[model samples]
Target: MHEMAIAEGVLDIALDYAKQNDAKCIREIGLLIGDMSGVVVDSLTFSFDMIAKGTLAEGAEIKVKHVPLVGRCTKCGKDFRIEHYDFWCPECKDGVLKIVSGREMQVEYLEVD
Candidate 1:
């Protein structure tokens, strides 16, 4: 699964940062995952736990903030959450919605000790 790869990447980042900062252990990892990113939170977490067993990041808490798909209407200047892949503006049907957020997966922060 791609989640395994993603988890590996995350662990690498955490470990690299901890090593650079002279941290003995990693406490937490903050992640921002968009709805359209297609990353499964549970699978990612499980994969991370499995791979982190012998690392400094073992038992580290993974804090995830789910980001919803948001779009802005070009004609109506309305910003709204896009549901079911709908691209039409709710207020102005003539305007097409442009993606404002979502489709992202990134590590926001890491707590180390």
Candidate 2:
């Protein structure tokens, strides 16, 4: 699965950072994943667990923060939260929407000892 690759990347970053800081071990990993990021949390967690073995983050707790979809109306310049995959603007109703959030996949921080 693609989650394996994703997990490998995350593990690489965490290990590199831990080595740089001379950490004994990783305690926690904070991730920010948006609704539109197309990543399944459960799958990612499982992949991470499998990939992190024998590493500094072997027993680290992964915390995922979900971000809701948000969009900005191009015509009216109004920002609103998107629900149910609707991309239309509520105010002007004819404006094209540009997604402002809910498409990100990033590591927020790592708690290392």
Candidate 3:
């Protein structure tokens, strides 16, 4: 699964940061995951846990914040949350909805000691 690769990336970042900071342990990691990012949180967490063993990031808490997909109407200039993949503007039936956010997957913060 692609989640494994993503986990590896996360671990690499954590380790690199810890080394740079001279931290002996990594306590937590905060992530911002979007609805359109296509990352399964459970799978990603599991993969991270599996790979973090015996490392500075071992036993670290992975905190995830969910970001909803928001879109803007191309014609009416209205912004709204897109539910169920609907791409039509509610204010104007003729307006097409363009994505404004919710396509991101990134590490936000790290807690280390």
lDDT of each: 0.95, 0.92, 0.95
All candidates: TM-score? 0.91, 0.97, 0.94
Q: Rank the candidates by TM-score, best first.
A: 2, 3, 1
In model 2, the Cα lDDT at residue 21 comes to 99
Clashing pairs in 3: none
Write the residue-wise lDDT of candidate 2 on 1-113 in tens digits. Answer: 87777888889989999999999999999999999989999999999998899999998999999989999999999999999999999999989999999998889999999
- Can you write out model 1's per-residue Cα lDDT over 9-100, one digit (the tens) per residue? 99999999999999999999999999999999999999999999999999999999989999999998999999998888989787977888
Colliding pairs, model 2: none
- By TM-score, the better pick of 1 and 3 is 3
Candidate No. with top TM-score: 2
Error of 2 at 23 (Å): 0.3
**Could you give candidate 3's per-residue lDDT for residues 1-113 as a string of tens digits?**
98999999999999999999999999999999999999999999999999999999999999999999999999989999999988888888768778888998899999999
Q: Between 1 and 2, whose lDDT is larger?
A: 1
If the candidates were sorted by their lDDT against the true structure, best first, what order would they fall in? 1, 3, 2
True-vs-predicted CA distance for residue 68, candidate 1, Å:
1.1
lDDT of 1 at 62: 100
